[model samples]
Target: MKRTFRLSFYVICLLIGAFVVSWLIFMPNGQERGAWRAETGGVVLELTPLKATMFSETAHSCHTVIAFPAHMKLVEMLEGATVGMNGAQLELAIDGTLNTQRFDRLDALPENCTAPDPASASARDVFDAAWTAMDEHYAFFDLHGVDWAARRALAPAPDARMDDAQLEDMLLAMTAGLDDGHVHFGSDTRGYRSPAERPGWIPEGSNLNRDMLRQIAIANAGATITKSQTAPIFYGLREDGIGYIMLREMDVDVPIGGRSMDAMATAFANVLADLDAAKALIIDIRYNPGGSDTVSFGLAGHFIEAPLPVFTKTTRIGTTQTAPFTAILEPQGDAPDPRPVILMTSKLTGSAAEILTLAMREIPQVTTLGEPTSGGLSDVMGFTLPNGWGLGLSNQTYLTMNGDLFEKIGVPPDVPVPFETAPFLDGKDPVLNAAIAEASKYLQ
Candidate 1:
């Protein structure tokens, strides 16, 4: 029985050898030498060069047989003499090294390739793809969308062989394709500032456009016709013996009662004292981007005698956190008067401003009016790569006081009013007219 098994194994081996030789003889010339393969988090990329290369001829007798693990696009691997693969964090490591970087065939795969991995696409990838698509498919690339050629022209010549710092600048320009809010390079907290403070990190002539200004204006257009400034407190007044407050941002110049709240509680007290019927109040938080929710709740306490859930946050891991809120009418005064109150909002309102809107909904005396808010309400966290490129990812979901989701969608106001055009064009807001009208009716 052993002798018969040995003979059968030899026969099988002989047949496999014959088949391999026959397949190799009929295969196209040099098909085996130019093959490349890679794996990016289980997604495989495979490439085969059609022609013979000097490196392939020297590596093996077949003159064109190279094996690669399939993880990325085949064309991208073939275009390079050296290939680097990034892991889940975009940490780079060499995947394959080649003898030469030249490809000499018309049908050969082109340089600069990408694979279609949905989950692997980072925020930077999304920005890069959006730009490259418009650059290639737009009818007049130079004249339309963000200027791709102009941004790239700022880069040194390809053969210039740039250092890490120079290369970082080129990458920054390349990633600025969408030119949208919350997407920036170098640093995460590079706040929008006056033109005189433009950093040297970015190339020249890259100024904000009308679209960018529109985004900022809409977000800042809270519930009143108050003056616009980057400062936290803009204008405050006592209207009809009622407390009226206009705040652009959450940061305060001084702590409120030494509690370290970002809201100007002292200023709020001073304004409240000036009002006779200060029982009712108006808070214009339409353009407020957001700040410490602690301040939001501290302000909320003035309205509610008892604590109420202002908002809740659910992390990506499913843990829930609830914050309580109330508002104070006056410092060292009685509890917030439950009299009729008006809170203003607009499409430019977002983040903590949205939370404040929802929290007010819990109070029977408060009425919110205006338009839908700017829907940039996702809970995002900043991440910086080893290469110094910054990114923001939406990892957690936010819910309003009433268990309402605020991701991508913003708070909807009780009353919707369209802003008049001419005033808006001249940078004079007309939304305040609508809010004042609504508040006046309730106050009367």
Candidate 2:
């Protein structure tokens, strides 16, 4: 009986030992249980909110978005950080299935580094500042084939005897080499003009007004005039069963009578309803300076039967990094009946107007007529010099779906109608005339 009891005790001890061995093997170690490591290092360029974007020398990459662990309070540590600083590093420790991260080390920034103050900076300082601004933010140096370093060498250094006017001229000459129509440098006293030429038809002094243009279009088409002075829409059906709508500009509210988008859309719908029986439509955007892109989308929505991707824009976020986003036109209201649509364009037709043309071109039945566009589609970023001079530069690029760059190269017309001032002087619009003839072909 004693031997049997001892054997039972030994058996129970063996079972307990087996359970301990299994627990040791299966249970995670305290140090190894919930730990992961991810690390990237780069020169800090921009720090906003909980995001840090940097230019890393190893990969030659910029605008890398690094998310900080909430527990680390890294953003607070970056409060003193400044742009153009080098030797910035980040380390993150992620814990467990929750994947919560903690900062291993977020070093405080040194106080010695800061951007130069533009307020009291010298001429050379101002020039250098402007150059650096473009170097860091301008989106198209390589695309424009501009040797920015070479241009910097050509800039005259600030001398104690130099006047503001001379400094302005030097800065102007430096920017002129870029050949970008969007680049501008100016002070209250004077400004620099870009030599880039815009292609379009410009009527003589008195005939340049919209009233005269409307009259010419009306007389040429033999169409009764239905106009809203407030909405600034000129629309009617031609006697030959062709429809015409002339939009001078796209604005949410016009100064003439406080015209709103709803009013504009209503006006558009009314005109289309009147011309519903017409065989074709002619959209005249000649000399229309572009306004809100939202307005352009709203206008394009009426014509598109489905959601159409028009173009995409890429903005420079670092010296060599860019972020791209797309703009699409969603169908709004009922889609108009598919018909042959001719869009009239000129050098004066630019910005949102050009965007409208791009959206319209996506429609299978639409054709762009007249001269090439003004080629100013991208949004401009403005900068101010330390010397109180203001500068504007194109900091973004726009492209079509097939990846065509149209910054300086305007959108070409399918049917080219070379604009001549003589035709307008003689009470004739050859461009409009050409569109009418083109529409007639589709009707027959």
Candidate 3:
């Protein structure tokens, strides 16, 4: 029976290797031999002897990079194309399959093709450039219910008579119409930031200080606090044996007292030692806005025993092409104890903070409490308009492991706790109280 089992295992390994090799050999590497469709439509953004880049706003809000074949006819067709012209497209037969792409609008031709002087360009020039740029680069118009074409049509024509201030107002209004929190337009003298209603435990501008929170936790929960010098991690053990940790932010740089060391990692290791000894832990992330996701994954390592798949993301490659990928949070070191943990969240918990919340939820022992997270998970990309104004927009979409898109929609908690400023101001944290109560049951 031992020999039979070994033989079966060897056979399975061989089959797996064969499957991998076949996949590598047969997979489309984006370069397939096919006949070129000469007459296609798009706005030529860049053209060179070896490659061509074009933008198609009507079909997909992205630029397509195409490698030129050695065919003279294809090269001539590309050379004949003019940048900022709407009439261009590509039809290619790859691996015996035909695919066609079309781009309808051109915002601005390449700088080499037609550079507009920012100081003298008409308001119409700036408006058209901004509109075209959004049409090509802004990825979430459909998701956010933005009618780009209608917005463009409604825009007042850029008059040469308009001053810089007037042009700025028009452009800012155009961006504000999108209603995306990530979308913003800024120049030297003025700026416009889109507003979002975030659900946080602490009210905005309430000034419920972090130091006060530490005092409240220590006094109310009978906890001993250990503050880290390298990172904003305040942790301690409660008298009831439940561990408490509050992470303020992820991106903190501190001196290591003349030693070449990773401060965040060292701080996390020390906190994990204290947490491992406790029967349970309460992680507070209410005030955290966001930072690097790597820090969140490092914290997740203390509870998860193996690599955990947290979320999936897709980036727009072309007008109709999106490349999807999964992000996995790998365990960093050995977790000595996988005890129950209660995570506290708020509306201020966003970006990497929200990602950490999701990662913690993958652990069976973790129970999340408080209001839902601030839904701003998508990745932001920046574009510069003709007038040197910068625009930031969400270009990538993130989804949960179960394939749920939570962009602009927060991740709800397992236990809902409404935020009340009065109770917190009085030094009575109802959320933390409930968490302690819940943890006591797990400890017992």
Candidate 4:
């Protein structure tokens, strides 16, 4: 009887041991824990086998990996990245994923997340990784009007038995048909711009700066200006009761842990207060490279008096798009009396700025002048290739209030003008003068 009882006890212990071993080796998820924190925002991340969740006091968001991989591969790729998460998190929030925080930096890594160097990753693995990521989550396969499957078939060296340059060229070829500037991939040392530029764009911004734009406004419009300390915003009053605001980018420069929208709001209020006496406003986003959508909407709100249907957003994930979410821009913060407001744009104005332009278009008093916007309206969804190459792709679509698709086709101006440096070279500003002229009619 004693021998039989001992045998039963040993058998039960063996079964328990086997179960734990399988869970650890085959599943490998039980070890994952909270490993990283954003440099700002008090946001923390919890990474599991195939999912990432970010949370803060007031917000929580979850993002799932579309194509599952062995646990360590994802960790290695992430560890290789020096920047991102802000882009990753924003990609979700941009397309209406709830409560995803924009984090510029992560403070740590998953403990014991050791893997072979990414250099040893085969080209086939990298290629397959990129292809699957896009196929599952890329939002513009229909908009770009190309068969993504074909891109995969056409990928050179289908075996991925090539060198880095060859792999990059193959990857670039895959995206050559996409009209999205936000779509690009690269390793830590090298990069490639989109082979296709927007219809009216310089892949690089127009190289205009706020200081130069401010100086020109002073020269041509007899303007008095002050640059914002908290952000890349500059504003003052121009002659003939016109207000001028030069937005270098839809971004602010607050320190780590500072709230960007709050900082922008304070700066915007100060600008509005100074230009309170003006009858109209000239807002130049001609030199702006887009940043936070929150800041963009926050600033745009100051120019309106009523809530309006602005834009609709949709995101692609795991082979399907989420249900469309439409948004309204409620009148927020300080506002001037309803009067003409000109949004000056160049091909340089994009992303969040383009979304801002779309919002402003709904208002009766707003007019967009100068060149068309960059037309890249989607947020840059972030990913990591098997080789640890960082990848960003347009994963969201922003439709107009009437459901117009405006991805590659930029936001058309109410008053379009040819983009040329000649006006600036000759000590004149035609776009500014034209905007002022347009605003004068409203004032009269």
lDDT of each: 0.44, 0.62, 0.62, 0.66
Residue 321 error for model 4, in Å? 2.3
Ranking of predictions according to TM-score: 4, 3, 2, 1
RMSD of each: 22.1, 17.4, 14.9, 13.4
Candidate 3: where is the Cα deviation over 4 Å? 1-126, 160-172, 177-179, 187-190, 197-222, 254-265, 425-427
lDDT computed for candidate 4: 0.66
Number of the predicted model whose TM-score against the real structure is largest: 4
Quote the lDDT for 137 in model 2.
Answer: 67
Candidate 2's residue-wise lDDT over 214-252, tens digit each? 567666765776875445567878878899888878754
lDDT of 1 by residue, 384-437 (tens): 332233443233345665567644345777777754445544555556656556
lDDT tens digits, residues 201-265, model 4?
Answer: 33246634545654675577657667887778777776588898888777766444345555566
**Ten-residue region with minimum lDDT total, candidate 2:** 94-103
> Which regions of candidate 1 fall more than 4 Å away from where they truly are?
1-185, 188-231, 235-243, 254-258, 262-266, 276-279, 318-334, 426-428
Q: Estimate, for each residue in 1-444, the C-alpha lDDT of model 3 and write its tens digit.
A: 999999999999999998666545433223322222222222343433334443322231222323343333333333322222223433332110011233332344433333324676566756775676667656677777777778776467545566667766887767764645567776667877665433344567865765566566556655777877667788888878899888877654434231111345556778878666788888888767767665676667666667778777775554853556677766655453477889988776777788788778867889999877777665555544555565566666777788887676667889998778898788887778988998899777
Worst 10 residues of 4 by lDDT: 56-65
Comparing 2 and 4 on TM-score, the stronger one: 4
